[model samples]
Target: MKLMVHYTLKNKGLLFFNFICVFGFIIIELGLPTLLSQMIDVGVVNNDDAYIKKIGLTMLAVVIVGVLMNISLRYFMTRITTNVAASIRQDLFEKIQDYSHNEYEQLGVSSLITRVTNDAYQVMLFMQNFLRTGFMTPMMFIASLVMVLRTSGSLASYVLMVLPFLLIGVVAIAGFSNPLSRKQQGNLDRINNILRENLSGLRVIRAFVNEDFEEERFDKVNKAYEKSSKNLFRLMSSAQPGFFFLFNIVMAYIIWQGSIQIDQGTLEVGNLIAFIEYIFHALFSFMMFSTIFMMYPRAAVSANRIKEAMDTEPIIKSKENGVTQTETSGYLAFDEVTFAYPGHAESPVIRDADFSAKPGQTVAFIGSTGSGKSTLIQLIPRLYDVSEGEILVDGVDVRDYDIDALRAKIGYIPQSAVLFSGTIKENLRYGKDDATDEELEEALDIAQASDFVAELPDGLDTYISEGGANFSGGQKQRLAIARAVVRRPSIYIFDDSFSALDFATDAKVRERINEETTDATVLIVAQRVSTIMDADEIIVLNEGNIVGKGTHEELLETSSVYYDIASSQLTKEELGK
Candidate 1:
């Protein structure tokens, strides 16, 4: 709830005006009844036409003022509520940007999406209702109750008698609805998770022929969500009829007593009319206020979820005034580094790994699956910190350098190529924001993508769909390499980036990279033996341990682990056996 208050208070002036309108609106609503009673009691009864007309005109003016105030209140409330929701979502996104991979895995991705979209929307709806009715209803109820007591203390007793029942009903609804709201939100997250998987992996699901199975899985969750929703609606629906029943009973009793008094000449017809109006306003206001109370439990649940995401402290953050500059660039080393995931520290993934590289040298890592080939390169950019030892870039510890500065020194391409929705030129600019057209073409040439790109109708202006779905796997990978190449960073990390290309194209791309990046450090993680055969050094990993290290020729003779991998991928002639 504090999340709502924080953003809402930013527009204090609008809130003030909203409150003023509500106050004026309430005054007009209560005053109109009083004016009607006067017109009937004095003007009509005494046969004074002018007095009746004057009171009628005053009532008309009051009603007009009420309408204007109502409109202003709604306008201000909408502006404030929309801004608050938007700000919360924007801040949540920026906060997520600062989170490391560990945080991302800790909070499931689909769950985070739900909090950003659905939960924020819940807050928005609650704010709109609260700003409109939350403030106005209580004041109106109290004022109308005062007028009720002044009109006829005897008849007001019936209205007061029904108040306890309504209060208990409101409290009961809030208590029951809260747990249901939480369950509903949790179910929504599951639905989103399944939907994301289905859309992203639609081809795989079809290939596996599991459409029926997937439909059954979706139906099961959907039914559970529907059951919860129906139960919640049932409870709310029943409460409304029960409230009106109590409301009618009170109205009937009040009118019955007022009529008997009027027949006995103890109460005038005008006072009875005024008393009925006051009673209606008072009880109706309480009902409106109760609706706000009912909304509070669900809104509070959403507010807490948003707060949890916003309050998640990113495990990795830049040091205040951390080292940003070094005397050199592209000097990389790992000093006896040992690493494990957050919960699997006892089983280290990369144990006692020590290595170094300088400019003009290419280091390649190859191993069987789950050998931490990709993870090893990720450490250079601090996607996950080293658990035991230090990683140095340009002789400065990675932890000591500002996070952004550390990453700026390296061009990293992950195991998968991900492209956003934009033109070819826009995607390349991600690596170097202000890179020139000539620089882009040069990078495309080096990545072996210039020919395909030139054949396109729009060339650099061709739009790439989300995730580059329109392009082949090989094309996306090459474009990814070009994006990195455009940066011209001091160090380049390619994590299994060439697996999509054929052997011939792979050779050409590597040949181009070798000749071009002579002055920059290059590290490649590959499973293909031919990919790393010409490297300056090759480190082989098995079960997270570096079992062999040497060049291709040297490893074939001395390191049996490297010999076995090379033999499996290369024929007798290629292995020189």
Candidate 2:
């Protein structure tokens, strides 16, 4: 919330101007009822036509000013709110970009998405209401109370007696609503997570005819959310009407007491009328206060949710002593490296993993599904630091090297082929923003994605749906490969990026990448034995331990784990090929 305030102040003058306008409008609102009371009592009841006409005209003028001030205030407040929201969104997005893999994973995607969309929206509503009702309600309440006290102290005492009830009601509603609002946001996150998963895997769900099952799961989440929502509303519903009733009871007492004073000649009819109007104003202000109380709990919950994400410290941090390295020889080495995830104390994901890939050499990692092949490659990019031991890139501890500089030398393609919604050319250009059309085409050609791209009506201009849903799995993989290739990094990491391609296409793309990138170091993490069989060296991992390290022939002779993997896909005849 402080972060949002800092951004809001960047346009300090505009916001301050909005404040002046809002306060001015509040004064006008307070003046309107008071003026009407005067017009009715001092002018209408006095039989003074001249006095009535003068005050009546004055009231009309005040109304016009109030209307104009209201318009200006609304426009200015919107300007302030819009600018503030945009700035906060930008800063939040920029912070997200700095987050490491561990930090991102810990926060979880659904919660972050909710913060960006729903939570930010809540903050915006708070700001808008804060400027409008937040300021006006209190000023009006206090000012109206003062006016009533000056008019008649005895009746004002009745108004004062209602204060405790209003306060008590606000406190109770706030207490009950706070926990439910938090639960509501949490449930929203859960629903978002489920929806995200189902949408991403919609094809698989339909293929397996599991629509009913998924629908039932979603129905459970939806019902839980609905129940919580109803409970919160049921609790909040009491404050509004209950406060109205309490305030009106006080108003009736004031009216009855003032009527007696008027009949007894202690109070004039004009004063009695004015006193009643002031009571109503005072009560209305209390009602606004009650409304504010109702909104506070939900806004506070939303603020806390946003704060949680903003407070998360990135598990991976760059060292102060780190220096940028240019023109790296791309020498990679893992010396006695051991790493484990946050939980699972049984064994490290990659333990004492010792291996190296020299400049211009292709090193491949192959193993069973849970084998630490992908984990080992991730260490090279410093996605998660080694729990114990060192990883060296270009003969320097990877941590000692500047993160951006080290990453500049490495092109990483994850197991998932992620592409944003954009033109084919824009996605490719993400690797190297300054990449020319010729460079893009050359890289796409190397990845075997250019042919299909050219067939599309817009070619490189063709628009991709979110996550490249417009493309086939093979095409998405090829485009991802092209994105990595466009970077022209000295180290290329393919973390099973070729799995979506057919065997022949995968082989062709790998050959092209290898031939074109002679000076680059290639590290492949693949499930297929055939993918890495021709590598200069292969590391076989099983259950977080390096079970084997050798060439294909050497592995077949030395490692049973390697033999099992090789035997799974290869017939005796295919092995010969």
Please give each candidate's TM-score.
0.98, 0.94
Each prediction's Cα lDDT score?
0.91, 0.84
Clashing pairs in 1: none
Q: Which regions in candidate 2 have their CA more than 4 angstroms from the true location?
A: 1-11, 33-46, 571-577
- Report the lDDT tens digits of candidate 2 across residue range 431-495: 99999999999999999988899899999999999988878989999999999999999899999
RMSD of each: 1.1, 2.3
Clashes per candidate (backbone, < 3 Å): 0, 0
Model 1, position 454, has a per-residue lDDT of 100
Per-residue error (Å), model 1, residue 40: 1.0
Top of the candidates by lDDT: 1
In candidate 1, position 461 carries an lDDT of 98
